[model samples]
Target: MNADGMRGGGRTLAAVDPAPEPPRVGPGAVLRQWFHGEHGVAPIVVGLVLVWVVLAAIAPDFLSAENLVNLTLQSVPVGVIALGVVLVLLVGQIDLSVGSVSGLAAAIVAVGTVTAGWPFALGVLVALACGMAVGLVYGVLSTRLGLPSFVITLAGLLFFAGVQLRVLGPLGSINLPFESWFVRAVQQGFLDPRVAWVLVAVWVLAYLGTQIWARERRRRAELSCVPWSQVVLRTGALALVLSATVGYLSTARGVGYSVVLFVVLVIIADVALRRTRWGRSVRAVGSDRRAALLSGVAVHRTVVSCFVACTTLAALGGILAAGRLGAANQGTGGADTYLTAIAAAVIGGTSLFGGRGSAWSALLGVLVIQSVANGLTLLDLDQATRFMVTGAVLLGAIIVDMLVRRRRQEA
Candidate 1:
């Protein structure tokens, strides 16, 4: 062959040869990537740990079994409401009426069971229905009538507050029987130590099983998967942390049934949001409503569902609170219930801008809020100081969120 032809053939061979594959990412890099991901929950987790440590140092009793048990109980009502708030935020909507809705639900339960001579179970169901009905109205007003959610829910807040007052009458309070099943369940029920340990084991096993299944599925689909080593390490770490938590709590009154309920609800919500079509649709709508509509998502339906979920959860929270306090009164859902619930959702790393959050945010956020309140009380601080501190923490969370969002956009 001629020299020119030989040279050309060599160039073609070099061009056709596959470039060397990029270096495989190490487990450490994978961990870092996961931590810095757009939807990462690492910041909130780290912050929670930091807060706990600081509070423990300041008030040794803060870490006492009794105080921790009280803390978990205190977090229940706001935590439940915050879960629903996470859903609403996911859909880029707000419900300012959650506190009022809770108050109304409590009032309904009180009136139906005490005044109207109805069964407790029946009264509870009616209260839930009332919540759902109010949510439906709010959903219609906001979606069908093209009204802003802020305005609609603000009106709802006032309306429900009035209803709550009227239902309670001039005396404005009704004490629940302390020995009632519902009250006992909320305020006194706790898991046996054996059961708590078994549940923790099951949770760890389930987590590992899911991870393994996901890895296999990804491999079969020819998609990238986390290294098996990384998976094992993560599972081990999770098991250790969960086991420690359960053990510590068991030394006290054991884990509260309310805490278990909150955890289960958060898990269910997390799964639904991460795995279900409806969850994806809600996220898409929140991210860009016009785009979601163009993609054939039922935007109106998603909005309605979110509102309904929010109000329903709110009602459940109120019931739980009533059971804990052994009463439903005009003050049932007053004070900063509204602010605290919303702040907990946001501070737990749920983005106010929407389209990014987790149900776990509610759990973590409420813990932070409750920890602050508990710590301040132990130090003999007044309500005004508590409010200021909580407000500052909330502001810091928002600032962090904004910075993280900006970084994500830049990336």
Candidate 2:
């Protein structure tokens, strides 16, 4: 194959196939292809870097301290929602109910604490647990009952909304005290700018170290050892952006509490789906249920777990929404959070067909979607215009994915 063909083929092969031998390609091209193959996040990262540069040039205030912190806060919640979507996408399913579940969770938290006088901590836990429980139920229905996740979670979207209305009853709005530690932590920035950089360092070190350790273990087991240079280059590339971005944002107003929570959620989720035995089975079942069954993977269990994980995360997003909104109302999740969540996942590079995605992709996707949304809204554009633009972006993502898929088959 020619180098361009090899480059096109290398990406999809990364997740599902072994690293192939190089064809006729220059050393520089080989390195570029390898980097793109292993880290699907790189393209999105470049896009983000470009965005920062353009936005800063166009609107000097775009990189100002206040705006930077707000951007982090905004990015964080979407990142959280995307994490849940990633799990479902990995398992070859889609949950349309996440946006609704998010609304439901926020309504419950607001109603339980603000209206019903429940403790803030207990209310938050209950909201989150309930969201997770609802997800688990959907998983059972989809896996045990053999209903499609599309239909199941779609029903869940409505079901959860009704639950939200019932909880909010009569008075659709209530006040939540901002003094509580949990509330403050979820809403306000912690770890001022300097500490935010330190936290980012910890995240980079821990993530790379864990992956390197895994590569070493594989080498010991006679599995392919991803080259040391490959690991180093990828890690360094990631560190450059992460360190710079975190430093820039922290200097503005320190890292937003929501962004930190978002990062933590993504890490937990990525680990759960990619690092665990259950995570393996989830991917296996999604890629091919029959093959998974033949290989002794619990196809049913994996499917159910994937659904449960997705819904629970959806619920968590709803709670985060409540924090951002400062109340639960008819309008809280009414902004099509569910659709956006799906769009964010799909556009962030999650496969619509199943068995290919990453949690980090969700974060990146959300950033893209929200950046566009926010940028448009700032120009005083109408809702119709925004929706039309969003539709185009979503369509573009699907096209890229299909093109990538076709190229993979050809290879």
Candidate 3:
């Protein structure tokens, strides 16, 4: 061949050869990205730590084993309810009536077991069924009737509150029997130290296993994966934190049954939201309902499911709260309860704009709110101040969320 022809042949050979892949990122880079990324949970985690330190400094007894255990106990009701709120928010909907629904469920349980001569188990089931029915109604109203969720749930809030009042009737309040098995389990039950430690270990192992499986799956799909070292480091850190928490709690009363229940629900929710096709649809709807509909998602069904989940969890929370207090009263589910649950979900880093949140947000957010309340109580602050502080903190959290969302959009 001529020189030009030979050069052309060489260029053709070079074009046919595959290019080299880029160098994989190391653990340090991965860590940096995690800390700086829009999706990072680091801010809330760090904020929690800082709040603890401040509270500990202000009230030396704030970190006491007894107080910490009490704080955990106090967080249960709101945390459980907030989990439902998180789900609703993830689907870009709101259920303002959850507190009233909770109140109604508690009333049902109290009236059935205490006044109507029904079995305890039956009462509990009835409460849950009522919750489901309320959810179904709300779902149908919002989805089929084309009513706004806010309006529907707002009406529900008023109607359910009236129902709760009617259910209580002349008595207005009823104390639960302290000897009841359910009451004792919710308020006083705790895991043995050994069992707590074992649970922590199992959780750590499960987390690591899932991470490894995810990495392998991504590799198979030719998608980028986290560095193995990053995965190991992340797992190790999580294990250490979890182990330490369990060890501390074990030294006190061990983990509360309520806490365990809350954690289990959060874990289940997280898995469903992250792994299931239904979860993807929820996210899609939250992100853009029109787009999700165009993509063949069952937007109406998803909305209904979310409402159902929210109300069901709210009912469970009410039951737990009744157990904790050993009573179901006129004040069982009040406006304060409603606001606190919503605030906790938002403060825990769930975006009010929806499409971005996790079940863990409920847990984390409730802890922060409860810690603040506990610390203020320890300081002998009045209820008014507590409300003000909580409101301020909630406002701050919303501001942060909006700023982060704007940044993400800009990016």
lDDT of each: 0.84, 0.72, 0.84
Estimate the TM-score of every prediction: 0.93, 0.87, 0.92
lDDT, candidate 3, 1-411, per-residue tens: 000000111112244557544343555545444534534566667778888999999999999988998999999988999999999999999999989999889999989998997988999999999999989999999899989899999999999999999998988998888888889999889998888888888988988887888778877876666667767777888888888788877778879998999999998998788779998998989889999999999999999999999999999899888889999988887768889999999898877776878788898899989999999999999999899999988887777667766765664
Q: What residue pairs are clashing in model 1?
A: none
> Per-residue CA lDDT of candidate 2, range 93-195, in tens?
8888887777778888888887788988789889889877887788788777889888887788788778777777888765566776656776774667667
Question: Which is the winner by TM-score between candidate 1 and candidate 2?
Answer: 1
* Residue 133 accuracy (lDDT) in model 2: 88
Using alpha carbons, what is the TM-score of model 2?
A: 0.87
Of candidates 2 and 1, the better by lDDT: 1
List runs of model 1 lying over 4 Å from the truth: 1-24
Ranking under TM-score, best-scoring first? 1, 3, 2
Ranking by lDDT: 1, 3, 2
